[model samples]
Target: METQEANTKKVVVEKKPLEKVCIICAKGSLEDVYATLVMANGAVMEGIETNVFFTFFGLDGITKKQMNRLHTATTGNPAMRMPGGIPFPTMLGGLPGVETAVSGMMRKQMEELDMPPVDEFLEMITAGGGTIYACKLAIDMFKLEKKDLSDEVEDIITIGQFYELCDGDRTQIIFT
Candidate 1:
């Protein structure tokens, strides 16, 4: 009898740790920016090389003028709900000053939870050795100069250069 059970071929690949994480932020909404910040900060804390690229409206997250004064999206947001989980009315969200008030309340809630503001969060990430970058194309499109960006921004580079930094086999590119 052929000893077929004695012959086996299998391949087991070793798992490799992440060497770097490149995060791309394309939206500037308060929630979107916070999501990117949380992910980048977490990766930095884990001792992984972290790089954040802010493009399109996401530039608002790093722009000196808008960073601290970001507002939560009120209109067209399906997740908006009342204190008791009642769906927030669409027309109510469009009312004047509603967004600002809601954003203020949200910020207050975040403060109570010890969540640092945008600027402070960026500082924390940088202090942990995470690098922040702005998209050159977006900067030019918005007619913004380098001085308009936060001090934490390492530089404004093109997508090509950003990809070069992401050249390692163990690197991951995440879009937030």
Candidate 2:
């Protein structure tokens, strides 16, 4: 005979919500940038302290000249496909105009889904009290001035300063 109490043992664990989120954006492609933005935005919406740091090629998302003109990388993307789910040929993806057309289609699809433009998305995130930062090392390497970045950028800081913000028992550091 088996005892029901023994078979149905109870387990208790501590429940805690994330208090802060530090997200790092290191890629420049449209999809990657959007992924970072979406996560940061979602965290802000949840009333969590959100800090977004853009570095390397990801600076394109905050660069005033390129923010609105970001494009998706169709070539070498294994999951890239046509509108109806047909697999896109890698060779065709590398052809002239194909990348642009595909990126345009992607942006169009996002727009149809009511997604905001990069600049507007940044604005929304900031409006929600989320902080945006540019990596100082990347800025120096790219020869970019603070004025070249989007107004939404709160500051340019070193990775060390960024890590300082990651301190907290309930903080999450996300590298996207």
Candidate 3:
């Protein structure tokens, strides 16, 4: 009896069960876009089904003109930080190309950490069964056409549609 109990206790623990994640991206800036991407990647890594919904300013992330030209936050974002704990000046960020430069640096940092670029990251997620959707309201408000969206996007969906996708699972809704 004691031997049987010991054997039972020796069983290795399993990782957490896979959960479904619904990520909402509401901002168009590089930081916000990266935040959404990172979370999606994490969910994928943890064997979870993930869906990303881009709405409002967040739609810029998937737009044809701005996807790769995202800008970094210099001011008005309390989380913005420079190298070695330095705080970036809000004025500098307003200068032309500063945001682009900062965005490039952040991308490089991610690359150094062996993380994939946003484009390929989205590709990986979709290829791995994750889903991406653009917001209908945003597209209409911005006068955007389907042709203006990135090829990686799955479709343009309404808020109601997004809710429908979240149904019937232990789904977690997160807005970044």
* Number of the candidate with higher TM-score, 1 or 2: 2
C-alpha local distance difference test of each model: 0.92, 0.94, 0.86
Q: Write the per-residue lDDT of candidate 3 for residues 126-157, one digit (tens) a residue.
A: 88788899999999999998899888899999
Clashing pairs in 1: none
Worst 10 residues of 2 by lDDT: 5-14
Could you tell me which 10 consecutive residues in candidate 3 have the lowest summed lDDT?
A: 9-18
Q: What TM-score against the true fold does each predicted structure earn?
A: 0.91, 0.92, 0.83
Which ranking of candidates, highest lDDT first? 2, 1, 3
Candidates sorted by TM-score, best first: 2, 1, 3
Instruction: Write one digit per residue (lDDT tens) for candidate 1, span 82-118.
Output: 7789998989999999998888888888889888899
lDDT of 2: 0.94
lDDT digits (tens) for residues 1-176 of candidate 2: 24656555533345799999999999999998999999999999999999999999999999999998889987889999887889999999989998888888889999999889999999999999999999999999999999999999999999999999999999999999
User: Quick one: best lDDT, which candidate?
Assistant: 2
Q: Model 3: how far is 66 from its true place, Å?
A: 1.0
Candidate 2 at residue 57, lDDT? Answer: 99
